[model samples]
Target: MVKELDEKIGALPDHVGWRLWRASRAWQAEFSAAMRAAGHAWFSEARAGLLGHIPRNGTRQSALIERSATSKQAVQQLLDGLEAEGVLERFPDPRDGRGKLVRYTRKGLDALRDGDRIKLEIERDYIDRIGRERFAALMDALRSLDAGPADASEEASVPE
Candidate 1:
């Protein structure tokens, strides 16, 4: 699959492939800046949203950290800021009083919802520019790439 993708990429026009790669980073910066300007900055929006999905008061902070793919310290920092902003609250885990559980406040849920709406709007605009067929193909290709086996693991396991 990697070889096939490499061949396809190799066949792309130099300018097109280069611009596609460059545009991804450029778009990320633009989107992050827009989110910040809209008072939804920080990578924790997705993390907070995921936390919201879990049963409140029953979910543990460690679970949230794992699902968010962020370090415990980083999650704690984001949680602290969110708590200060009244977006979420931390409580002692009933299962283990020493452990903490995080839950989103009404404000936090609202913020997450608003940020998602904005992201959808931005994506819609980009898709509109790309046109439906092209956008569909691009999305399908990206999803296929994402679903493929871990290339890094395969490479590491190969005989030297």
Candidate 2:
């Protein structure tokens, strides 16, 4: 699958292909560092916004765990820790009293904004390094890829 994908994209010059690969890794690392520097104790914050992308009212902890790609125990630990820090508040789900709904406090929102700012700065740095035209082209390519179907077998074949 990788060979096939490579062949498809191989129409580009060799240096461009190599540069794209390197830029992908650089952006991934930049985002990872930005997430860490945001001082979000939970990996959930790293995954999405303060309130999370999942619907708070209807979602379960298991759902959050699955969606966030974290273990249930890890998610619980993070939730507890964040609650202790007053970053998130958990309330009884109005729809399901037995279930809890998690949402961010003002502090959590502020922290998320800080993380977004860091991400923006990283992106700006990349644009400055690569120039706006190249950056825009790269973004377009990324969006195209993102809109494509997920190929699990192909993804599994890739070496980490």
Which candidate should be chosen as best, given lDDT against the real structure? Answer: 1
Which pairs clash inside model 2? none
lDDT digits (tens) for residues 53-133 of candidate 2:
445333565567777777777788777877787867778877788878777787777766776687789889979999999
lDDT of 1 at 65: 76
lDDT of 1 by residue, 1-160 (tens): 9998997777755685687679776666666666678786544444444554456343688887777777778778777877787878889988898988877788766666776777688779878899888988987876655555655454344211
What lDDT, from 0 to 1, does candidate 1 have?
A: 0.69
Q: TM-score for each prediction?
A: 0.63, 0.61
Per-residue lDDT, model 2, residue 147, is 56
Model 2: lDDT of residue 1? 97
In angstroms, give how far residue 135 of model 1 lies from its true place: 0.8
Clashes of each: 0, 0
